[model samples]
Target chain A: MPSPTSKPRGILPAALFAVVTAVVVVLGIWQPFEPGGGDLEIAGGGDPVRGEALFAESCAGCHGEGGVGGGGGPSLVDSPIDEETATRTVLAGRGTMPAGILGGTDAVDVGSYVVQISGAVEGAVPPVAEEPPLGPAGEVQLTGPRLWGIFVSLAQPAGATWTIWLDGGAQDALRVGEIPAGQTTFADPDLGIGTIIDQYNRVIIGEQLQDFALATDELSEARITALKALIIGEGNPPGANSLVSVAGEQFAVFSDHTRFLVEARDEANLANIRFHSEHLVNIALGAPIADVDQNGEPTNPGDGVGLLGQDGREGYLPQIDAAAGVGTIAPLAELVPAVEATVADARVCGDIASVEAAGPCVNAIEARSAKLDQLWGQVPDAARASAVLALERP
Target chain B: MSVNVFVADVSSGYADLMETVFTSAIVGKAWLATAAIVLALVQLLSAGRIYGKLGSARILSSRAAATVHRWSGRLAFLFTLPIVFHCVTILGFQTTDTRVAVHSVIGSVFYGAFAAKVLFVRDHRYPGWVLPVAGGTLAALLAVAWLSSSYWYFTEVRFGF
Candidate 1:
């Protein structure tokens, strides 16, 4: 029997809370959500070594070992394929090729390895076939007290040789002994100091290098002074270089995805565009290196979860969250909920803490959700949205 | 064999079997805990209705709510078996940290509280408020136990199996 004045219990709020808690638990257990495939899915640098094994497992049957064309697939060697073409072809699976034999970072890793071997196999030019980046022309060895294994993981497996260029000499393809990948030199390469700086920064933040020697024996004094600034910043946790890594990736990765979003829009592939939007939202909110809820580093995802070591690793979202999700990360906050809403509702909108901001998000989600198929026209707007996120990235 | 060794054997044996269904024992524990929480909520809601703390203007009459509460309570208890067995036998009692200490303390009392609540339900001679207090205490203890271990794992470590 019910009281005459009894009202229905507000079960909706309780149900909604239960649902959110379950999602959070899922996200916690499934840290490092997979990036749905796109041309730019695996942006920037990747470990070719890890990719090589993945390639062997996933692709060698069709593409042959070391990508030296087999009876089943064309020789990747001497192939003019750039990273973008390779990525798109591999993910979309052209001709008799199957789609998604590999995906996510593994796909990107294989792509990186494929591009490297494709050029290296037949004395070919760099993957991009561009003129060498010019800078200080000097040859120096990279050696230190630390085991080269750390750098090896960065590039070149043990006993497998890498070819860097002493393009400092008056020769093209001026090959140096096994150096790391980022110390890049295309045939007739014009090497840039930026390459060395990038590599050194990675070594500093990602891997602990005690007595890691930076061979500057042959360097000009001016170069050494610049190197000194970078060297001095090492050994400190969350160094300026670490911030640069996070901040830089936020812009670079987000910008790359924004371009992909535009392309997906042209194709009007709803899933693909939504995929990039998800990454954009990730850059704006979800993915973070640190556990935001706890003061201490989280114990899950034990792969250096809060180490802030990996230069290109995911952590900016956590950083923003740590900073209290405010005056920072301004990527089309207004328009984002419209797209994020398409990601199964106001879950993402809840991440936007500003009550005032959330008002439009809830409305936009409801209004524009039914029109997702026609969301292609909004690609240009997504690009603007990405740019908005870029301003607030790290 | 010693009790510690026997406990370890049982825990490992159960966990090894669980691996066939889950990626790891912890993962199995996670899903089980989630199921228990959902069922516990059902128990809470239905109990509220039966006690007149809530009214069933909807399809739920007092008798139906009582039935729902009983079944949900049984299922919820069943779901906690594997988790509690593994935790007690494998990990045992520990006060290594604040979270662990708090969880261990609450978990130690949960079964006792649950037993008391069950007895109180059957005994018409008991005071009116005792059963509800014991039942609420059991649920709160379970919630806190979940927050300490499984929740931490999902949030701080990994979310999916």
Candidate 2:
């Protein structure tokens, strides 16, 4: 046997293994150090003073000054609504209140202001029921004013029916009969727009909750569960309720169809292409196309909400004249064939294998390009120049 | 493909939790960096002791030193898993700024260097310089990653959570 002074055989490896295993096990069981309580700090800290100003401008009309009860809106001061609920309520609107017009930072600021001034009790808003808010998987019931807002904004003729062209050339005609004066389930739950609207609503809810959690320096389990539910859209049909389905669809189409079509002519003219195509689509949708003033600012704002409006104006407009003063260009329907022909020629050029075949492809591309140029050229120089100038302006 | 999807889902699932658990985004990263640096020092010192280059065989037996080095290295690697997961799944590989670009490149290389070091340690048939080179590269990459992220966070951004 070896002397006692000599290290035991295999002890080093055994000891090392034990130590590593123990560390792993301890780490697995040990709770990560959470910066809860006083240790937590909100990222990009909020200013309640600035938030107060924003709230007065955007919210006081309905909520009254100092968030006291007034004018069809409930009392916001000492309101039981938590920060999360208040933010979501402001963003999506509830009951008679319209959806908040404020963007991200402004929304957060207003929310912070409301929380500060109102002394809103935390965790006051009741938990959402376990059941999915939008109904079952394939059949999601789209109810509430937010969905109505989206429907009204995107409706084909601002009344009657909405038409959506799907990815495989299937056209869906949804009869939106009347804008619901109150919360009502949509008759057609299977429409893709309903699904998109639902997803958007959930995202808004989740984001507000996240903001609340950050502001409070506490990510409660309830908040996490709610956020996860909203994000995952657990009960929705596979791929329908996810952000990947809604926003992803928009992005993919914009990239593959719109970008591809525009880039075919001249890759360097993306800014001009974006301006023209977006406005063209806006015009097609029967929304107002704004006229630029001498300073290149949109003079006559189109009456449409969100990014769909060409004029970069916010709020609702009853009727938008597509061709007020602009000279006669071909109708949007007439322009589609030209755009398609150009795209087809570009594709053909991409597929050509022979050097000799390149001549005809070039000629075909040039002809289609000229056709589009002539078609777009019919519109008055003022309108086109205004759009170009607006695009270039900060 | 399924595996990739699964990994992505799991990574995404923990992203919010990770963000919440950390002190502040910047400070939490600094803590992780400090831990990694300390472990790296332990690894280097133990490695030196194992090679008998520290001039004190009495301090720790070669086998004991090797064991310490191995475990310290493993611990360091374990510390990086969550950071890597967050970076890959949530942040993706973005080069929007100079700082982010350098961090992204270093983070990408750190994993490869780690793999090389682990392999070299196990396989003795390689040239003697291989293990040292691999270890040194991993250390260097980790240092750069720490500097670009945590260092920048502390110096430029506030130190508090």
Index of the highest-DockQ prediction? 2
Score every model by TM-score: 0.32, 0.30
Task: Please state the CAPRI-style docking class of candidate 2.
Answer: incorrect
- Residue range A1-394, candidate 1, lDDT tens digits: 3343554333533454355445433332332222222113334545677877777655653454566543135667766565555654554345545333444445556767787777743463423313321111232222221101112122212111222322222323222234332443222222333233222322211101111112112233343333323222245441344322334344445445555555555565544444554454444343243232232432222222221213455343333222322323343233334444433333334244444444453445445534532432332222212111000000
In candidate 2, what are the lDDT values of residues A1-394, reduced to their tens digit?
Answer: 3444554333433354455434433332231221111222344323456667766655653454556533225567665444554544544345434332342334445666667666653543322224322210111222221122222111111111111211211233232333222222224324445433322322110101111110011223443333223222346463354222332233233234343434433554433333434433332222453321112432211222311222444211111113211222233234445545544453454344443443454455455555554543432221211111000000
TM-score of 1: 0.32
Best by TM-score: 1
Chain B vs. true chain B: TM-score per candidate: 0.90, 0.83
* lDDT of model number 2: 0.42
True contacts kept of 2: 0.00
> Each candidate's lDDT (Cα)?
0.46, 0.42
RMSD of 1: 31.9
